[model samples]
Target: MGPRFQNDDRVRLYREMYEQHGPIAPVVLPGDVPCWLVLGYRELHRITSDSALFSRDSGLWNQWPNIPADWPLLPMVGKQPSILYTVGERHHRRSALVSDALAAVDPFELRDRSERFADQLIDRLCGRGSADLIADYAKELPALVLAQLYGFSDQAGAELVPGINALVDGGPDALRGRDRVQAAMSGLLTSRREAPAAGVASRMLHHDYSSDFSFQEILEDMMVNFVAGHQPTADWIGNSLRLMLTDDRFAASLSGGRHSVAEAMNEVLWEDTPSQNIAGRWATRDTQLAGRHIAAGDLLMLSFAAANADPQVRPDRTSFTGGNSAFLSFGHGDHRCPYPAQDIAEGIARTGIEVLLDRLPDVELAVSAHALVWRSSPFLRGLASLPVRFTPTPTSAAGVYR
Candidate 1:
């Protein structure tokens, strides 16, 4: 599902998997959980498109009887009341509610917030002449911005960052992190219900389909939305910066070439997407996919990184994929990340990168690009740290962001 080794090249790993298994192949998860890994671009698109055949409901999984209580994949594959597992008419309404709430976010305000948070992060390190971009800037920026949009005050948002990071890492702290985030969400919803102020939470509560969804259901959706928004956007920012700093094609970006920033960001989506794989769809009935026989209730893990690099669509894997947005970095069809949500993510990532380059024009790697390590997770892909050095400069004199 992901790079086995911290230093393993993911692109090479995906290539090897595709060459050996073609489009679809069987693979084992951490607990020896068997599932189909959909690696072909066309195959993945078909699975997402036909939700009636491949349902999002984890309850349909045939492996549930064997899954243990302590299993690590439970958090992902577990049957919850969130929109991820919702089906038919209800799921459609829930998706619209979320999309509309996120769509209501002002683009100008979003960009302003992104730039403000980015500058605040860079200001802390600009005078040091060196910093780990992943920890200091990339990882912190998304959550802070998202917290505000999700209806939390600045102090409350700052407090939620550690829990959000821990939750995504899926480490031992994951449970506690989940609790922390849940508690904060619960509080936010309670307050928004009372005051009905601005932000996604408030909007969701007041939507036309608001009554169609229970309070618990809305809370679950907020949890899903918050986690989904934070980590991947953070990874996108980090991965794009890593590409621009390391690849010769983007060398001009580090030297004040603004246009290359967008090019580098787009290239990262195709080549080094953050949301690499998904826990995925469960079969509703027996069906054949890519010549493989599927039993009813069988699980299918989406290999988005593999699908994006599928040789069928991308015959020339080495060539630049300039301005092409056809990549499956975000899934397709019914369960795909909403368009407005995608726009919000792009705004945050692009603004963050642009602000960093504008602040530290000479920023370059402090360690060799090859020496950089990746975070080992079965789903998401991102650098562990991106240490770099640049000329020291004074911190920003603006007051702290509220």
Candidate 2:
């Protein structure tokens, strides 16, 4: 399961796993750590729905004794002050604080800001005739827009991009990247505290429940929100564009008609969601799941991709999903992604894609579609680089879209 997670063709891998082991299967993580993967749609829904039995609190993990201090996955799954591990009443308050802060962001402003940043990024490479969409466009857009939303200047936001990317990639630099992002968030918190303003971080600082938690803990929550928002949204843009470029059904999106953009984005969420798998819920007590004997303190990985592909729900896997939104891409139940955050991600990703198509109407993949490479991350699914070519449009004409 550890090596299979990095496989480029994860769809087939997930299908094989489901066929071989049913909905719940025992597997070892990268560090030889053991856990069960929830692969069935109904099974995942049940686990996420019953948070009392399957808890978010990672401290309940029984394998802690075997986990080394320097374990690569510690930063992700290990107990942390962030809301990801918080549970019960306190978690509810924290969730409201984060959600309200994000919800206050004006949707109109978010869309306009997304377009502005998308253009700025595309403007940088519009005259080059060729570019890596991942590096130049998709990766940088989300954080820049989020920076402004979080009260950071564009310069500060731009500075944080590389570190945020490295952190989400879960590479050797992940810890270092996490440190850099935390420092930046700390600075922002200090600034917002000194002089409050209209931004997500400021709103979070002023939330009624803000006083309940220490400054460090709130800062940790801020980091989680920002990171969670950034990478997945970026991958959404990249993956949706990959689909639009390769699939005939969405080619109309590149030719001035805007109708297919939404379909492509929605379809991507179903077929190739950026968040393919999640670190997951821990068993609070001994329980039976999918006819398997699961003991207390056992870790359960949520396989969103597999769940979405479950034959029981999606009988015809090859059929177009269209407007159906039952996918678990953003998760479900009590711990699902905040509704406001989901809207923000959707706005940024959809606006980014629309703006790109309007600007470079003739854009096409530079290499054979088969030549594109997926980033080798077990948790994330996105292209390492989406090399593309288009007729050069001068920077001076950037605002003049088709």
Candidate 3:
């Protein structure tokens, strides 16, 4: 599929694939890379949870040799030393280190700081009576917040966010973005090692980490956190606001005092998960997934958006408010986001969204929801921009969005 069709209207294409191929469908991506996509919620859970049958190791993938070098699939399916790319004990060790490091962060601190960032961004353009929520608000809040959590110097966030954004975009600029991420991580790691600052890198170095990680491995781990935290979280916030701005029932509920920001966040998770499709995983052995024939070392993808909207699994079409926990948006099994840590992430999002809604209660979409642009990535789902208008709110001496 071309970039425009794959990104803007993929939800419809996914439904078509499901109708023809059922739970598991075989399709080729932009570079003619063939892989199976799991559309059924139950089937996706089975493949993702049962890691023994579906390995996350891209090295086991036999398709790489056949694929061309400049296929634009390397960033997603390529080998890496991070927990995201590793399997088995290595996965466990890296996960432990990350979990411990995230645990060290105070959630309250995160919420407070995130509000400050949101307020600061909003302050920049609040008085102008217009805002591109995606650019002014949604983009940098998560970027800077994640930078802080990842232990990078807060000053570097402006440079760091866009580079990582390129990495996750999964296009021609992806490899370039990957290089920036590595260099940025190296700079931060070397700085942290010498000065010994506070964050994931600091804790990872001093804590009783489960795995003996090399410096490069540590850099990869930092990339994983920043990548995981940045776009997806930003999209979650943007999509949640889009929902609140576009859906009448949703907007009424939230504005009419019937719904909570947490519910809105979950609603986005349930239906419009940030990473609509995950382009990793390979068959460990010859097997039948959901009664479909599959060979060993076959590349696979999980359609989290499709799976969450499965009619058989989730029949309730009434509301997207209270999201189900079973959604594969954040994934499951060994590689899924851990508890409380996941809660912390959601809290940051909720706080960020709440800050905007409360500050700019009269804000309305400047364009039709259907007119918004989505980023062209094989895996991620993000709005290109969310233009919004709000009545100018006066800023006080305390420097709030008013």
Candidate 4:
């Protein structure tokens, strides 16, 4: 078995393994499960898309002791079981419901709401000179957007953020937070069902399908969607801001009005994807991947960071100046993220960043880059504290984002 990975050691292990061996590497978990970490773009894509061979069902997780049996996150309804864990027809049905609702909603409507939220957040931080990017901007934007989608009040949205954060960033106390989040989410779904709103929650409550979905099942799906949609997005926004503020070339391109901020946002998504590792999948049968033999029941973990950074796939990948590549920050194929509103959120974020750059081009990090603490979740990557020093941009006698 490999050395037990402490919370701090996973990133180092990932970096060292990626730097030494190309993308895919064999790893033995502390639990003695032999797993292949698929890192290369091609391999990651293959494993994630090949649903027949790799199963998302939590059956494999039974091998590991860390996961709880009554884990609120697991899917317990439909033909195939497990919330985010099921596969095949059941997964397809659940995904269709989400996609349909998202499709019915106009992206522009979301953009308008996000822009307003961004403007307010920027106004609050405008004269402060420095603020924690995670707290003030990154965390706030996504929560508000989610609230709008769910038709929840701003206060409810704000309350969900810390619980969501705690659930994803597992520690000794994560279960406590997870329990609270689960209960709150269940309550929210119950309320939505009792008093329907004109939002995704209402849509889900009324969604008609052959499969029967219970309140708990619906809540689990919503919770997954909530976390998946916001957490990584928030991380990407925080990381992108940090990168642009420090790198003059990138910052200049953003502020110069030369390259579109939309393009820059894409570059940020491609360059610094928020999610580093995806959950493990079990191989149903023997398989050959990257010239390695994988026995049935073996686990595979996809590394979005490694795939995005692969030189073979993204030549000149290190140069974040610009790129046309679509990053797998949202995953690929059957497992693709359901929230299509990201483009809307990104648009709003880009506009907000542009406003910041235009108003305060000389803004620099309040502390050295090294002093910024990176978030420790293996699944998510972001700065916990991104302090910056900028001459407060004069509240444009005109309004913000005008």
TM-score of each candidate? Answer: 0.97, 0.96, 0.91, 0.83
lDDT of all the models against the reference?
Answer: 0.90, 0.90, 0.77, 0.68
Clashes of each: 0, 0, 0, 3
For candidate 1, give the lDDT of residue 265. 85
The candidate scoring highest on TM-score is: 1
What is the per-residue lDDT of model 2 for residues 1-402, given as tens digits with 9 covering 90 to 100? 345566556777877888899999899987899999888999999999998999999999999999999897776698888899899999999999999999999999999889888888888889889999999989999999999999998788889999998888778997799899999999999998989998999999989989998899889899999999999999999999999999999988999878899999999998888998888999999989888999999999998999999988987878999999989999998889999999999999999999999889999999988888888776778989999999998764436322
Model 4 weakest 10-residue run by lDDT: 72-81
lDDT of 2 at 358: 88
- For model 1, which pairs clash? none
Give lDDT for model 2. Answer: 0.90
Off by over 4 Å in 3: 2-9, 169-181, 253-258, 316-323, 396-402
| Residue-wise C-alpha lDDT for candidate 3, range 100-173, written one tens digit per residue | 88887887888877887777777878798998988787777887887777777657776777787777666689
Error of model 1, residue 40, in angstroms: 0.3
Encode model 1's per-residue lDDT on 1-402: one tens digit a residue. Answer: 444534556667767788898799888987898999898999999999999999999999999888999897787788889999898999999999999999999999999998888888888888889999999988899999999998898899989999999988888998899999999999999998889999999999999999998898999999998889888999999999999998899999888788999998889888888898898999999998888999999999998888998988998988999999999998999999989889999999999999899889999999998899888877888989999999998777644443
Give residue 274's error in model 3 in angstroms. Answer: 0.4
Model 1 whole-model lDDT (C-alpha atoms): 0.90
| Order of candidate numbers by TM-score, starting with the best | 1, 2, 3, 4
